[model samples]
Target: MFGELEMVKALLDERKRVVVLTGAGVSAESGVPTFRGQDGLWKSFHTQDLARPDAFESRPELVWEFYNWRRQLVAECEPNPAHHALVELERQIPNFLLITQNVDGLHAKAGSKKLMEMHGSLWQVRCTKCTHAREAREPLPDMPECPVCGHLLRPGVVWFGEPLVAGVLKVAIDQIGRSDVFISIGTSNQVQPAASFYQLAKDHGAVTVEINLEPTPNTGLMDFAVHGKAGEILPELTTGLRESLS
Candidate 1:
């Protein structure tokens, strides 16, 4: 770990464009469930069946029930050390971007500024009829309605079979292309496009690192891998970075 910290420090000292990608593990540290791995159940229906456009179109109330439940669950948790450490890192590095696959909004709560939510957020609502979307922290009704269109409001997250928001994906790709350092934390490395980002960064000459509880399929490709809880590891790494870059 000491040796890897040295390498992480070296990467930080360069102070070039740095991108950090996070997944469910980070949010799990804050007590958010990896909902996909759960029983996938929702009132006798599979969650996977409900997390698609077709489900929302067919049974909007059921979809809203699931997302609203998720929203409350996520809202109960607080940002952990890793989230705060990343906020400090963002402050330290001018060209830093934090990309997260989780929809919990813990990063935003941690004060991350140069951040992009790859999976949208549970705290936001969008109208099905109009293009209205806004952040809402309170618990949503079973069938939230848009202020503008009065249409049913839906969770802002990316559902199954849905493509990522194009504009967001473009920015994420641009950041990965420009980054000189890419850090992957708490990800399974199975989700497409995002799972491929570290490699994309490496291909573009970035030093890629993976920090996870255990190795995944792409762990072998990482220039460095740190196996540990992100909350414990990130703060220590960020402290070293502050010293190295001070």
Candidate 2:
């Protein structure tokens, strides 16, 4: 409960390139489950077992069932205050990039333009057989076969054991490396690469800020750790940015 508004504002005013790396905590504010934590994983399935390419390949229908549940969850939750606040921060700051680990698409829904979806999005579909390029769309009920290669349609998310899409990862790394400020929101900081970005940004001289409900796993590394719900903290912070930058 430090004042997120003033501190975030100061960081915004001082920094040029801002990189925002978000996690499940932010999406949890919008009502999505922290799916990787204890007592999660598609009806007693382990996250390691369910969220893997091998699992999807072995039992596509089961994978679809799990992701379909996630898709509906994302579909139901609206963007929280934090998401909207980041959208406003993008408007206020110059050269801002949003890099999100959550597959839920709330950041885009909040109108953030320059974004790197590190974990991919649920609202997309790709062919399994030929590996067709992705299309931004909803999942179908019949689970229609791909038009080109007749492979099954699968939800587009970064499955476990999959390297993040190289193109997106490159952009994320570039943004983090070039940033003078890095803001971490609503993430537990346990996941790799996404968790690593804040350190990467800090290593490149970016002032690191963490906005979340508690001290994150990487709290020791952050320059400013604001402990609270992101929904309440971010709008106030965005308002501070407006006050300071003006």
Candidate 3:
């Protein structure tokens, strides 16, 4: 890990465009649930059963109940060291972008200005009838409604069957294509589009790195694979980059 850290730091020393893609494992360090496997079951319902548009359509109340629970749970968790390290990376890199799959809003809380929440955020709500959306951190009602319209509101996250916002996806791909260094952090590397981003970066000649608790399916593709808790690895990696830059 130390040797790989030095290599990643050397890559960053080039001062080229850097892009980072993070996932649930990053937030899990802060005690946020990944909403997968056994622990994710709520009221005997799986996350996939409730996080789809059809599920929300059939039982908006039930859906809101789930989301509200998630909101409350995520609200209690704060940004960990990994999140702060990414913020530092953003500050040090002249051309940097952080694309995150986790919607917990930890990166934003950690003061990441150059960020794209590809999966949307738990802190936002959008109108079901209109395009209006806004941040709402408060405990919403049993059924949240849009202030702009009288219709019901839904969690602003991209659901299981929903496509990512086209413009945001476009920008993320463009950044990955242009990146000199691309890092995949704490993701399972199984989710689509994002799952393939490392390949896109590599195809475009970017130095790819993976930081995860364990090797992912895409681990073999990375120029460097550093395994450990992101909260520990990221701060050390970013600190090394800072020292190398100095």
**In lDDT terms, which candidate is top?**
3
**In each prediction, how many residue pairs overlap at the backbone (N, C-alpha, C within less than 3 A)?**
1, 0, 0
lDDT of each residue in 151-241, candidate 1, tens digit only = 8888898998999987988999998999999999999998988999987898899999999988989899999999999999999988987
**lDDT of predicted model 2:** 0.82
TM-score of each: 0.95, 0.93, 0.98
For model 2, how does the per-residue alpha-carbon lDDT over 1-246 read when each residue is reduced to its tens digit?
Answer: 566447767778877888888888988888888866563766778756888888888988887788777777778889988889989988987788888998888899889898888888888788877777565555567465787888787777888789987688888888789998888988888888787888788788888998888887789878888888989988888887777767
lDDT of each: 0.89, 0.82, 0.93
For candidate 3, lDDT tens digit of each residue in 68-110? Answer: 9999999899999999999999999889999999999999999
Q: Any residue pairs clashing in model 3, and if so which? A: none
TM-score of 2: 0.93
The residue-level lDDT of candidate 2 at 45 comes to 86
Worst 10-residue lDDT window, candidate 1: 34-43
Candidate 2 minimal-lDDT segment of 10 residues: 135-144
